[model samples]
Target: MKIERIYLLFYGISFISAHVNAFDPITTTLAVGIGATLGSIFKYFQEHCSSKWISFNSTGLEVDLENKLFGQHIASRIISKAVNGFMNNDNPKKPLVLSLHGWTGTGKNFVSKMIAENIYKEGMHSSFVHVFTSELHFPHASQIEIYKSQLQQWIKGNVTNCAQSMFIFDEMDKMHPGLIDSIKPYLDYYDKLDGVSYRKAIFIFLSNAGGESIIQTALDFWKAGRDREEIGLSDVETALSLSVFNNKKSGLWHTSLIDKNLVDFFVPFLPLEYKHVVQCALAEMEARDLEPDMSIADQVARDLIYFPKSERVFSVTGCKTIISKLDYYV
Candidate 1:
């Protein structure tokens, strides 16, 4: 009876040791007969690591918006709405869709980066954050079908694994027409469909299709002697939407996504004035741990090309080139 009891104890220890060894090598037999305890320890560590991996801090995002991004009130408000939607547990029924429309260097990508940074531990580098650029990922019109399949599969797989994933489609104005429509099903209003729920996901489209209209409106406001801050979403929402829809080259053009009002917000990135450019220069300098000088910022801002040779309205490229130009001053 004593020998049989010893055998049973040995067998149990062997079994537990094997499982523990799969995770980490046992340095001592002190772990023997404590399989349940060891398993709990392993689980705790796993949970700790996972908890450290995914982090979303709303306060951090607000601070970034105030400091990093400048002259983008409408865009900021729309982004806040999207972030709030993601964080809200009550309204998890539909994905937050944002159509970021503006010219290049006007903070579309910047705002996307800010959102990713605040929402994910890895930020823009997060595996769950997928960015597809028209110029880089899907340039050829013939490859639209392939791109559509890949995009759908990618979204489905990631959302299945983690519903809080984010998809950023950049340069939509340059994407192949009708290609973006493949995502309509996921963006549609459904409680649950096709055995998957994409309600917790977020989709952001960055495009320059309606950029001209946005800039023109802002310019018009400037000419009318109105404070640039007075320009609101109500001022440009209709024109911007119509421009993006009517423009044949726009990826959203003739697509049900826009017509059906699947898009939650048409966040316009307004053209940056020289003062905004100066602010960007100062911010960039501060980012590099250098004390910023207004004289240097003024010089950098002055070098940037502005629109309407007559009025010299605003920075044509916004703050896109501010960092590069700062190298000369620093």
Candidate 2:
């Protein structure tokens, strides 16, 4: 038997829309019975897969969600700052931990997970994973609706920024103010918040706002005046990196909107130190002796990631860098 296709609906809730079936009563009854059974099976498969998101590649790094929480955190200098900051903050609410990275950088996705994993391992309900950006409640109305309402109220409170956090909004700089406002409760904050793990929760809002956008907007206007001028004598750079296109040139995209205040909201939580961590991680790999067997990109990646107590120190971004950087190390 050939199976044509599989459609999985995780939410399970189905909206059946039917006008009186044009079929006779016996045929209509049969159709209804088949539809209900098919729908339930689809939802079950979707739910089964929804339980995990793993990052595995032949290149060496394996990031499993389970290992991250059960193991102690791995820190680079940037992570060290967060850990130290976490320990020192006696304030009832936790500091909002935010991180920003342009395209080509998976740091937002990578870093935020580590932070939440830390919170959960510290005795927080494993179910609290519900609060993460990749929540399993995706298509669920009741769980998602209730979570959003609580988060909205929490955002309005002016406690620590880590009060029930939001996600790693990909290209937030391109979003409209109206759209920003819709998620305002998730991004901006007021005072006197509660239930947030001021000691644990963090809002990691990543963006290319000031660095990429402002630079391009300025370049666009500068280039306009120079089109009539001769080349090489030009004071402005006319070319753009593909990374820049992936990271910055999203203003025209209807879906790429970010709150203008996102940076300000997250600046306080930004990592204070990364240079030493980057340097140390590099050193750890250099000491490995096996680094000579890899490429430059892999070498760079090797130095970039921190090995958790339960897992290896390889990651997707670092994997490419490892291959590229291998030559230098060898």
Tell me, by lDDT, which candidate is best.
Answer: 1
Model 2 TM-score, 2 decimals: 0.35
Q: Which candidate is the best by TM-score?
A: 1
Query: Global lDDT for candidate 1?
Result: 0.85
Residue 8 miss distance in model 1 (angstroms): 33
- Compared with the true structure, the alpha-carbon lDDT of candidate 2 equals 0.36
**Cα-based lDDT at residue 211, candidate 1:** 94
User: Could you tell me which residue pairs clash in candidate 1?
Assistant: none
TM-score of each: 0.84, 0.35
lDDT of 2 by residue, 174-195 (tens): 4322232333433334333244
Model 1: per-residue Cα lDDT at residue 66:
84
Which stretches in model 2 have alpha-carbon errors above 4 Å?
1-79, 92-99, 122-126, 130-177, 183-200, 208-292, 295-330
Q: How far out, in Å, is residue 198 in model 2?
A: 7.5
Q: Across residues 261-288, which tens digit of lDDT does each residue of candidate 1 receive? A: 9998999999998889999999998999
Off by over 4 Å in 1: 1-52
